[model samples]
Target: MSNNKIIDLGSSEDPLVLDCGKSIGPIKTAFTTYGELNETKSNAILVCHALTGDQYVASEHPITKKDGWWSLLIGPEKSIDTNKYFVICPNVIGGCMGSTGPNEINPKTGKEYGLDFPVVTIGDMVKAQKLLIDSFGIEKLFSVIGGSMGGMLVLEWLSKFPSYVFSAIPIATTTNHSAQNIALNELARQAIMADPEWKSGNYNIENTKPVKGLSVARMAAHISYLSEQSLHEKFGRNLQNKNKIEFSFDADFQVESYLRHQGFKFVDRFDANSYLYITRAMDYFDLKAENNGSLIEAFKNTNSHILCASFTSDWLYPTSENKVIIKAFNALGLNVSFVEIETDNGHDSFLLDEPEFFQTIKGFLDATYKKL
Candidate 1:
């Protein structure tokens, strides 16, 4: 296998145990792999994806036919340098992509899981990836890299299986979702469930979908991902291809039109129920909580080296949040590095073509890989 297709683990006696204490079996993990695993399997790296990403990391998205979201950063000669390392990216279990998610059918009822699907956490996501990695016969990973929710998964992977990971890069993510972040996620969930067509998350059975509700949810969440400076610079008060204001709520401003477009396009590819599940998982993420409210305790004896980063304009996961993680690593006397990139690209800066961000990753990984 070229690691470019789906791999169905099928049903086994051993099921994935969730943080909620529920066990699910026969999970189908959809992943894409690039480069090749060497004889010793020491050149493998795991790239986790953000909220809307899928397994198609450096390849064309099958649904959109557009270039991969992170194509600018991960390729043969790019910062990640696929030519020198084997990279694996898998869709989270509760994701809308090919992995087993809310859209999958329940074996007993033979219907889509929908709201019935189990709530998954960052730990659950990493546990599933462990299964996939073990299937590849790769015991230890050279590095695990991601930003935002992907970054959360990176931290979880290192925390849960320190011996299995050598290095980690968590960019623009917090150790836990703040109260404001939780509130914002709740707003999106309310928007989706409030739509009459949602039908209590049984829209699939009713042969209808909540398009308007999901679109509004996406629009609301999209605003939080950007900064005031970014929005103003990109759109300002510019009219949307019009000579005068429409006088009505018909997207009079260019920014409004852009957000509407983002919302509409999102509903086409993402599942509302999956969005609810994933956001809930993120809200429940609190590493310190698991370690008696002490961030330092969470890292107890971890040996994996960490490279933490934050963006100047990212209000979602600010530098303050990254500092907490860095402090914990330092308290543990662990090998860790940090950088606050100066940029106006907001939380999405990690995804954009930031030369310094690219170089930092290239330099860190290149130097780390040599020691392995």
Candidate 2:
């Protein structure tokens, strides 16, 4: 069973202001918590979810009936051990999960927000999360951890509310979206918008869905999440059941069938419009630009111990991109640790079962908690 919980934050009187100069009230935040909060509430750790991830960090997913996205790394005696730390994971505002998003009803129009939802930014998401953190009366978090887009949220927390975070781990992520990253996201967006069923984002009102468009979008984006070596190792040019190559334009190769499965299954649980919005938010993240083009200046305020990690084959957010963040921290003379895990799993390495990755995080958290 899913262990999701819902909380209402930012009422009409104190609406959440967005980077797009818009305001939303009574934002619904879906979250889940594991372990127990100590009397002082000092052992709380905020685990941010990545794109396409929900609040079911270490629990079963209600829709997919599969283990939580980070199930391997979190639990009773896992890396972010629930036996000792209180972990809170919130579905971001522009997500398709139980959180507020384009698919959610708009109280003003009595219909789904759809295209009317304000263009949310990474900063806006972090602001909404802060409200949830406040609702718990958590003055400070023991640690904040995440990977990829989730890592972006971790960095945002460190930048926007440095004092509130004690330690942070941002894995396989960058401070900003590189040009290549933006281009890749744009490709996915165009794929969705090109479908005839999209109907200008009004498909929901017509009782239709851009499933094909969304599927293709997922297919294209999924390739970026893996490395060439992993794909080759997993399913070379092997045929999909048949021995001879099929001359038709069908899924002849195992890899082709695998991607198609990933794409179609993704559309089953994810909303097309939510995909558009969340990807746009990721493309717009630029921590350096937010702080006047000074990465060091962005983090000069607080003294939180930080750990930045990147996978060796993560071309999407390569080790080089991650090093930029480390350089900034080093420039400020902050207590920071950086590790590049040797792996061929690419950007998705953080989500996989890597012994070194798990040990690195476990060792760091154990040391950090002992200090407190």
In terms of lDDT, the best-performing candidate is 2
Please write out the lDDT profile of model 1 over residues 1-372, one tens digit for every residue.
Answer: 134566766364778888999878888899998888999999999999988788888898877877777889898999989999999999999998889889988776899998899999989999999989999999999999999999999989878888889999999998899999999999999999999999999999998899989999999999999999999999999999998997798999999999999999998889999899999989999999998998887777579878999999999999999999999999999899999999998998998889999999999999998888
Q: Assess the local accuracy of residue 54 in candidate 1 as a C-alpha lDDT between 0 and 100.
A: 86
lDDT of 2 by residue, 1-372 (tens): 667899989887889999999999989999999999999999999999888888998999888888899999999999989999999999999998888999999877889999999999888999999999999899999999999999999999999999999999999998999999999999999999999999888898988889999999999889999999999999999999899897998999999999999999998899999889999999999999988999988888858889999999999999999999999999989889999999999899998899999999999999998877
Which segments of model 2 are wrong by more than 4 Å? none
Q: Alpha-carbon error at 233 in model 2, in Å?
A: 0.7
TM values, all candidates: 0.98, 0.99
Candidate 2's displacement at residue 157, Å, is 0.6
Tell me the lDDT of candidate 1. 0.90
